[model samples]
Target: MKNAFVFLATGFEEIETLGTVDLLRRGGIHVTMVSIMDTCEVIGTHNISVNADSLFKDVDFSLADALIIPGGIPGSNHLNDYVPLKELILQKEKEGVILAAICAGPMVLGGLGLLNGKKATCFPFFEPTMTGATPTGNGVEQDGNIITCKGPGFVFDFGLLIVRNLRGEETVNEVAAAVLAPGY
Candidate 1:
């Protein structure tokens, strides 16, 4: 149960949404995609209809070892609109669970003031949105258990980094060699 939970909303960036989950699961994490809606269905900004593993209410997110939010205009906005998603994000942080956000996703955490003084990195647009972040220019930044990545370009690195941290370097190397060596 290394992963425990992974949240995906409508309008999510296809790359960020899928890449991270795939990579982590390759490293043997138990990732679950929670939809923002009742039905386990979400349409990405690209109009890609991705079926989720469960409804947002169906999952006891508090049991998760980590909470992930992918970035995309509709995806992030969709997550913002869902009170349960926001609540889970806040509660995960309050309980000190590992919270990972990428691109605009960090803004969601910032809005809740979970990122004050933390070294965080997100898309250029989210810079202004982050009120109290250190604003690291690095492609990825991990502040304690909360890890943040830039965008889709860094999706592979973000996913691998988290897996390396959670599952150790050996599993990370094996997964990278097996899954990332060839183009997906």
Candidate 2:
């Protein structure tokens, strides 16, 4: 089974983060919720607390096929500030691993120069932060190994795209049908 790592820093968007995890899990993907913070309980922007499956330092990312980041205010900033996570992201990108982000999460990838020469999309206001990429206003945009979505409303598409990239179009179709959001 394809394994994915979803990083959760404090203040993450509860919908985008959990929705993606739920969707991917339904697709039969093994998703590990990783806390970039000191503890496994990371609080969301809306004050929802979620227990992560593992700490960032404890993960063996080398076995992961994809890396996901969900966006929310200070959460995105917090994710961008972590040196180890950034290094792992860069390494994953260089190795052609699927990198997915939504809302302000793409800004984190942008700051790392990973969006250079690619087409990306993020929460409307964050388009400017997408450094060297063409900022498309589409709800979701996938440029090679990188997949970006606009915001909470597009979380399903973002998750579906990630599934398509990792598993295939057929699996995405099956998963989408099961979720009643086929091609939405």
TM-score of each: 0.92, 0.97
Predict model 2's lDDT versus the native: 0.93
Q: Can you write out model 2's per-residue Cα lDDT over 48-100, one digit (the tens) per residue? A: 99999999999899888999989998999999999999999999998899999
lDDT tens string, model 1, 9-70?
77889889888889889989989988876678888779998888988777766467778889
Q: Residue 55 lDDT in model 2?
A: 98
> Cα miss at 85, model 2 (Å)?
0.3
Error of 1 at 140 (Å): 0.9
TM-score winner among the candidates? 2
Runs in model 2 deviating more than 4 A are 182-184
Per-residue lDDT of 40 in model 2:
100
> Can you give the lDDT of residue 12 in candidate 1?
89
